[model samples]
Target: MKKTGLFYGVNTKKTAQIGKQIQEAFGTDQVDIVPIEEAWKTDFEHYDNLIVGASTWFDGELPTYWDELIPELVSLDLSGKKVAIFGLGDQAGYPDNFVDGVGILADAFELAGATLVGFTSTEGYDFNKSRAVRNNQFLGLVLDLENQSDLTAKRIAAWVKQLKKEWAE
Candidate 1:
């Protein structure tokens, strides 16, 4: 299997922590954590499989670094790449726009021609609205570290397992 690049914003502690957990779950040999702070277009183009994550900012906006990288990311031709997104949000605090960063990133990757994977059910979340949801399922893994911190590990493990299967196909 090709090594997966796990890219995330290093400034956000929670998102970075979650990225680390994902790397550990896949084992360092199979996953590499790349800080979005230091990432270049080549980083996105180099990996066939990628796990990218971000934290949702106020009013459902993506973090600063991710927001700034949007144009560059959209310009890429990721025709055969596989991307799985994960986001950190406070559902109880931002119910109206829970996990919007995931949706935003998902859209950028889709526009770049990546085959997105790891769509998860939106069953247990309590939110009024979210762009991340489509057909009643989340675009990717959604972790509410504020309201659902206990479930983070389990969710990451399950998502990684799902990615392994999806990437195989």
Candidate 2:
């Protein structure tokens, strides 16, 4: 199997920790954990499969690292690439816009011509609204580390399992 590029913001403690957990779950050899700060347009060109992660900031904005890199990322011709997205948010604190960062990244990657995968159901969440939701499903996996930390590992495992199957198709 080709190794996946797991790109995330290194400065984001929670997102970084979650990225590490994901890498461990997939086995370190199967994934490359790259800090978004160090990723270039050419770096994305190295892998056809990618796992991108983000942490939602105040008012449902993406963290600076992700926000800054998006323009550069979208500039690439990602026609044949497959991208999956994951995000961390405080559902209880930001119920109005839970996990909007995932949606933002989804749009950016779509604009870049990548095939987005890992659409997940929004069951068991207490959010009032989100940009991440489309056709009644989240554009990607959503994890609430603040209110639902206990479910993180299980969610990641299930999502990774799902991604493996989806990518295979």
Candidate 3:
């Protein structure tokens, strides 16, 4: 069976918590939860599927650790790998740049030739603008933990279901 890896960059623990939620929803021992600090040592080729999580910083930047890991991520041969992304951001606070960190990661993965999956609809979210949105869709799952914490679990569950379908295909 192909293994799954969940890697995350955390600051306020919201991203970490979302990673944990995904780990639980996947319900498989083959899944590995790795912090961005240690993800540099991870063998990207070992996992057939990768789920990356990050919390957006001011002005739509990725968390510091994710920014640091980008070089290593870019150095990997991720072609044919299934990659998914998730991000935590404060839409109420940063309406102009909500969850843009996910877009940065998505771009990096795309550049590495990974097959990015799990793009989510931007229907219910209220944000003025975001790099994460393209053609009225988020690059991946996006959580507004500061303003919409109540929807996190449901959104995660739905996204995980979508991922399962995508990975199986």
Measured over all alpha carbons after superposition, the RMSD of each candidate to the real structure, in angstroms, is 0.7, 0.8, 1.4
Instruction: Name every residue pair that clashes in candidate 2.
Output: none
TM-score for each of the candidates: 0.98, 0.97, 0.94
Per-residue lDDT tens digits of candidate 3, residues 1-169? 3689888854447777888889898885857887676666356777899999898998999877889878878778898999999998988899999999988999999888899999999988888999898888999999988888999999999999999999989
Worst 10 residues of 1 by lDDT: 1-10
lDDT of 1 by residue, 97-132 (tens): 999999999999999999889999999999999989
lDDT of 3 at 109: 90
Which wins on lDDT, candidate 1 or candidate 3? 1
Candidate 2 global CA lDDT score: 0.91
Give the residue spans of candidate 3 off by over 4 A: 10-12
- Candidate 2, residues 1-169, lDDT tens digits: the string is 5758999998888999999999888889999988898888887888879999998999999988889888887788989889999999988999999999999999999999999999999999998999999999998889998888899999999998999898888
lDDT (0 to 1) per candidate: 0.93, 0.91, 0.86
Error of 2 at 37 (Å): 1.0
Q: What are the clashing pairs of model 1?
A: none
Native-to-model Cα distance after best TM-score fit, residue 85 in candidate 1, in Å: 0.2
Candidate 1 backbone overlaps, count? 0
